[model samples]
Target chain A: MTDSWLTSLITATPQEGFELAITLSRRGVKYTQPDPEVLHRLRPDYANSADSLTAASHVIAVNFQTVAAANNYWRT
Target chain B: MTDSWLTSLITATPQEGFELAITLSRRGVKYTQPDPEVLHRLRPDYANSADSLTAASHVIAVNFQTVAAANNYWRT
Candidate 1:
């Protein structure tokens, strides 16, 4: 696992594609189906590309305790 | 560059160390320092290890338009 999470995609048009990407991001609600412990929510205020939200890899978000608990639960 | 950013650190104790690490994370303000365009901010609500923050590698936060703009500015 390396304690990392990564996801990537190449855009045909960096600008338009980025807009679409973020738009889709906004369009999508943060949810963790099958894993209730994990609640995926985008960092608001980090809205605009110029304001916040830059070109970086996958975002890191976790409910570690829940994750650990869930992990334990599953283990049990 | 592979269009990616990466940073990593190994912890001695995953639990206590994780708390300390996140405490340090909370203590620090999101700043780009030299690169004003690259605004760094954490995804909130994602606070507790069980709440949101997980043992994932570094988080990704960016202001791409500013990044591109700043990039162009520096290039000019």
Candidate 2:
């Protein structure tokens, strides 16, 4: 849990930036729910739910926003 | 590009499934725009836009839905 996967958000490309955004979101979820068993148990309730999926996407987008800001929107 | 990062969508845990969903969404984008330069150029256009961010989120949600179905909603 202490291992750092994120060294920098300043990616050389948008693709990397987007990937970083996903990583950030995933890490956030892991931080919030460190217990894999509990997360697995709760998966059924939210997996098929459109609302939950949409919510997950929203979180990713927010992460993307943060990454974008960090990278200055990849502007030269 | 030939190296496969996706082994399975049937994760042992929901967290893993969610991460896979994010990967799927990211891969989709990469497929759509193989050129990093083009994607980077496009970043500024969508980076600060609420609609664009929301759109990205929606895409992730859709990918999540696919992963959920593939994993049978993680119902064991």
lDDT (10s digit) by residue, model 2, range B1-76 = 5555644445777778688767766565554345677556566655677876677667767666655655667787
Q: Rate the local accuracy (lDDT) of all candidates.
A: 0.28, 0.63
For each candidate in turn, give its C-alpha RMSD to the true structure in angstroms: 17.3, 17.6
Give the best candidate by lDDT.
2
Report how far residue A6 has shifted in candidate 2, in Å: 1.5
Given candidate 1, what's the lDDT at residue A6? 22
How well does each candidate superpose onto the true structure, as a TM-score? 0.21, 0.48
Kindly give the stretch of ten consecutive residues in candidate 1 chain A with the minimal lDDT sum: A58-67
Model 2 docking grade: incorrect
